[model samples]
Target: MPQDDPRDASLAVKFSPPQTWTAESVDGLATSGMFLAGIIMVTRNRILAWPSLILGVNSWINQHPLRTKEGGTPPVGNLALAFFALIASYLPLFLKATAEPAGATETQTPLSFST
Candidate 1:
């Protein structure tokens, strides 16, 4: 009878590729939480919230490694988060720029005052 080679078994185990990245389990939850928080902040018009939300998304994105199976790419969740954050953070500024002036000006006297 031929003896089984222990070295061969160990090599087989070592070389086998991992089915998935371990970070997905933790990062998925983290990304979801940040996305929810960003939505809330967007509704409230809090500009400060966008940066951290972006950071959380970036962390989740970095946790995954690009692979070559199942089309071999991570989803666009992070990119979407970034897009929404940018819109949320900048929309108010854009709207403010386009708004009508309040009619208050240093050069112009009050409406009650005559020239």
Candidate 2:
């Protein structure tokens, strides 16, 4: 005989919740931002500095050290680095003398800090 509805059985089928953006994605964003910031800092692309700083702050705000895979602490250092990079990117502009880039004209000079 075919059991139309096997309610008598002790087992029942279960379904997992659907996946969505989770903790790992946030971590990736944070790391990528840090790396990109480092690259921009090196390349002298000062205009792109703000995005990384935003990413760092966002990641820090969403940090969940307790729930992280390794249970590591929040990424305060990453944010700090981002902040530093932003400052470094803009540092030259505020100075009195500057070193022009390779592509700059002979007369063009970049900012340089003075005592």
Provide C-alpha RMSD values for all models, in order. 6.6, 12.0
- Given candidate 2, what's the lDDT at residue 72? 57
lDDT of 1: 0.56
TM-score of each: 0.42, 0.57
Candidate 1 lDDT at 62 equals 65
Q: What is the lDDT of residue 73 in candidate 1?
A: 34
For residue 58, give model 2's deviation from the true position in Å: 0.8
Q: By summed lDDT, which 10 consecutive residues of candidate 1 come out lowest?
A: 66-75
Q: Candidate 2: deviation at residue 51, Å? A: 0.5
Question: Least accurate stretch of 10 residues (summed lDDT) in model 2?
Answer: 17-26
- What does candidate 1's lDDT look like per residue over 1-115, in tens digits? 2357665654465466566643234456446646755774557555545664666566656655534244443445555565566666666776746554799555865569558
Candidate 2 segments exceeding 4 Å error: 1-26, 69-73, 98-115
Off by over 4 Å in 1: 1-14, 18-24, 36-38, 66-75, 96-115
